[model samples]
Target chain A: MNMHTPLMSASPLVLSVEGLAKHFEMHHLNRTLFAFENVGFELREGEFILLKGENGAGKSTLLRTLYRSYLPRAGHAFYHTREGIIDLALAADVDIALLRRREIGFVTQFLQARPRVAAEELVAEPLRLAGTSYAQAIEEARRWLAAFGVKPELWAAYPSTFSGGEQQKVNLARALILPQRLLFLDEPTASLDRNARHALVSRLAELKAAGVAMIGVFHHPDDVADLIDREISLEVKTIADGENNVAE
Target chain B: MTPASSMNAALERQPPRLMLADPILTMTGIEKSFGDVRALRGVDVTVYPGEVLGIVGESGSGKSTLLRMMNLEDMPDRGEYHLALPGQEDLNLFTLDRFSRRMLRARHIGIVYQNPHLGLRMNNTSSGNVAERLLMAGERSFAVLRARAKESLDASEFPISRMDARPSELSGGMQQRVQLAKAIALEPALLLLDEPTTGLDVSVQALVLDTLKRLQRERRITMVIVSHDLGVIRTMADRVMVMRNGDVVEQGLADQIFQDPQHEYTQQLVHAKL
Candidate 1:
């Protein structure tokens, strides 16, 4: 595990990614694109690490890879699971599903939902999955909505039809519903206004205090700059005919 | 983490045998009828947590009716029913109010019908149909429901790219998978299946069965499967209950029951399969 952050404590390391790499094959063009290579990081409990880089820097790819959204082409992501340390890259799909359901949480920039599902249900899902009673889960969803300043009237409205900012609020609320041990947030506040952003920051702080480890990519770093324990930058790698051209 | 120390810890942490200690659902003298036809007659059942219980019988044997009563889709005409949920009493479901019963059903029980059409909304988008149960369970956040529905669809091995299409647009096997995704989207404690793979082709049946087995084992879901196909029961069930003409003929471990059936009906059922 690479301890590049001064904020590390005796708290157990939740995730340790070593020499992780992601590459995409363009079969149509008969070429390959190396999104990132030799990326490594260690996230301890309660620490928040920020991902910094310009567009096309593979920042999102790195986040996605760690979250197991995209399979890593190489290396290991050792996660401290109830079953002990298991590599996310090599773990069975069933194991990954179990971890995602109970241990890990993710918030993405775009909101993807079923058409016509009400907003409250969206927020209550995580709580429900955690075995909370339906009434209690919905009640908690209502509480989160209030915290984010989502209008009560829109509680029954579908997030799929909501404005970009409103949808992001729902995304943030859903991700934060259950107390996650590890959280990956990608531009969670990109569409939020001042008040919502502040609310998100405060909620994130509460999670941090509760010893939840987090890795995030923020469009506005100033909003959460104080909460960040460390920073990792991913340089874009352009490959032509199997040759890598690194761009800093 | 040293290998020797970790091995010792793993041995110490091995879960105690929970086979029959925790009863998730218990039914005594359950009876149901459909007008002139008496579907179930004083049937008793006890399901332990994390155990797969199979109910096997032919059509009109009341196996499906028993499943419906367990999940509260239909009320039992006579008998006491109790559902054991964590941190709560063994709830007499018949005594609870309709709304409370509905809430419990949404939270604790998930059922997949023989016909996917009955379980899924044919007109709605695939994701919408999959998320319908959560919506009904009082989840009001569309974003969460949609995201969970998509997640469930992916987990069930339904193509993610086609999640936006209508259920009617998908093949029969795909539709069944979608319905399975929808049923378990809430991650309910008890999953009820009534001939879940009956209609699919043999190859598709194998695939669906593989998916179901993996899901049940991964989630540790307590399942009550009612199927005419003894092969399904043999593969998926830990215990087998043989039902005939609304009456339970015999009950025992799947291996024992299949190896040497006690009841004549069970013998015939096993013999037919052979």
Candidate 2:
């Protein structure tokens, strides 16, 4: 058996992206944009991968494509679970809300435009979507926010009204509250200062210890030093030059 | 050069301490208290045009509060904040009327927040965020704003292609660079940066500092950058102000402040780091 076979049988990889590709028509350049081409990586159980790249280098684009905010024109993404390996690319689009609510959690730097749900409302969204009762969702929200180091006084405020740092914490709270297996962060530390960055890092480590696999696009190496287990570098050959095939 | 001059030169690699004939923003006997807790007491600073001033202090030392004072967001209960625009006008910012103060902040004062997202509009495109202050500054034409945004982004080496993506879709360094573009697009005479490079990685931090200095020189914009990284303060600050217990512990040129720190606190801070 190949090396991956046994490892998969024991502790399966939480997420894997193989030959992931997204091509968009860029009107400004009068050509199609290859956002990701043959981008291959595997995140084992509890593995933290820091996806590093500059702006326009497809960092946030890849995160969005992975979270299925935008559909990848071609290629594959899979989430390996106890049941079996589920094709994330298809699950991401077909069962978008359920997929996002059940297995995937994405924390954008600005938090997405999911509406100006109050602190309680937004935090409770995923679990409620997963069919949790309102009282249970609110209790979960309160507990998660406190666990994420957010103050109780700001619980009723809209995410739009909170400060950038506070809003990010709310995003983290919402994405992480449901105990999803795969977590994704795009520039999560962009708005956070040093102390807050440290606090989030420590919290992420705790979640990592609890067997949550995360894919993060990190800019500050120091802020992400202890969080990442692998680094992915992007070259033209990866996103422009096609090289690999999708694996089953 | 002789050995004496060589040693002297080695000791003082940069120029002597910053001395201006007149000050741009001066704080005298500024005292601020929050109920019973004294935040700032008898703190003073003298800032000049085209100068990079670094404010260094630890947590709870009221450095953040002092920066808030610069933006006039938080006012000192005692003392005066005298603002002078050389060759143009001189006025005490503390004495300005509400409309005058709003006008000054909207047009003259530009602040780069520690969290670029807080200062930037993330929902709109990058060009929209960049031209936001220009809209605030009464530049209403869409064409001119777009042109100005392109020019500012080009000047700072900001990736012009990302103009359509919202702040949510950019890297940390990219967002910070966008904030710089927004702040400098107005070409404000005074720029205040609060922990601008604290969270950035070392390489990105260097790039940001270089960009800050380059903009300060090209635009002749007076800068006050707050940071805890002494190396950052050393590289960018013309004059470094050390704050402790909500007061100015020491103030001098970067060389003097780093080499021979007079205050025990400053010396300790230096030793604690590198």
Candidate 3:
């Protein structure tokens, strides 16, 4: 519950998550495990902030909750602007959907299955959400992919057969193609090779310099060592920690 | 009856001990593509018995794709794979049918994905997840299965007390231990691991990699590992294959490859990452 104000080196804060709490209820049992408790963080436009934690430390939970993949038991996500903040939780699903189109990008370590989508269509999704026409979105996505050395011949391929590294690169290509004010990358470098990871880090650095906001979750500290402007390290609390403390 | 019993009997009869001839697996002119996107265009790889092969490449270089094809998990669109089974004639792995291919994967090829949870069902107990694959592959009897699973899990250094705990209840390292237990329980002849140490702590990586090396030595498993990390490659691989742009740039012993990479592309790749 510390307020992490922006540093002098970066742009003003672009996105903020406040008082996030999540509880997971197992289907077979009535027991509910608290995944997160009042977790909070901030992302300045184009700034790289490392999210570090051990396994089951709620890092993934917090990221998933922010993306609306899992509904938070309680919290609000704020997209900051010059005059006011656009609160995602307060907005309707449609309104939030529009907001995602224009400002937010979520990249997962694994590809989420969707309907009849190729790499181009997948990358263009955020733009499509932002009210861009399909044709325009495809063009923009292709341009972005090309910049990263992804060839045109590969754009139409389904992601299922793509290697883990290939799929991850494609996933990154999608998130990064649009001019997003906010980006959340969960375990971005875990599956990537050193060269690819370096390429991504440099690309992210350039985006940060251009004032794009990002919050990256990574277990490998070295991957984000140079990119990170600040860090919020989570206490390594396992299931055992919770059990011992709770039982007492 | 097993698909190739006489072959198994021959292999069992003559154990290829310590630096055997001609290696266990060989891939030559293997090509794969999904629609128009050609993944591996003319790739050649060779893996020897008790040899740890590290496949290093940039993203989208077809390294992982190439490894998948070796296990028949991902089939090649063109070219044939000649597997050098110890006592049997060279088997064209591409010719195997679905059932046989799957059976082959169960008995001979096991892969560890980057994600720990992908292989194990999270809702099930540790022992359940560990035993489920083996049970499906064979070893259906309840008592023997449980005892076998318990013994294997313990031997993998994954604590037996948590054998009944679900994935959510286990730490990441413990969860990986669970996956390792499953992969080793079957005792596959070749193990395909993709970025096996990427997510774990350095200490945990050492533990897991050391355990893998030990198991590889004891079982004489030929490991075809895909890693982007050169440090990991240095520790695990006896021989290394350097791939780039969907092509093999260089292939040699790990020491030589690390010390003096012939291809400028490989040199750049080796130097750029660190």
Strongest candidate by lDDT: 1
Instruction: Tell me, by TM-score, which candidate is best.
Output: 1
lDDT of 1 by residue, B59-140 (tens): 9999998998888878988988887777655557888888988888877788888898788889999999878888887888
Kindly list the per-residue Cα lDDT of model 2 for residues A1-248, writing each as its tens digit. Answer: 11333443465578778888765532223334466677888887777778776555677777877776555556778767555666656551213333454677787667642223578778887777677888999899988777666789988877777777788878877877777788888877786766657767877888887888888887776787776677787653233335321110
Question: Which 10-residue span in candidate 1 chain A carries the lowest summed lDDT?
Answer: A24-33
Fnat of each candidate: 0.00, 0.00, 0.00
Q: How well does candidate 3 score on lDDT at residue A101?
A: 48
Scoring only the A-chain of each prediction against the true A-chain gives TM-scores of: 0.93, 0.80, 0.80
The reply for model 2, stretches above 4 Å from the true place, is: A1-248, B1-20, B86-90
lDDT, candidates in the order shown: 0.79, 0.72, 0.70
Q: CAPRI verdict on model 1? A: incorrect
DockQ of each model vs. true complex: 0.01, 0.01, 0.01
Query: After best superposition, candidate 1 residue A238: deviation in angstroms?
Result: 3.0
Which segments of candidate 3 are over 4 A away from where they belong? A1-248, B1-20, B86-88
Worst 10 residues of 3 chain B by lDDT: B10-19
Candidate 3 TM-score over all chains jointly: 0.48
Q: Alpha-carbon error at A11 in model 2, in Å?
A: 86
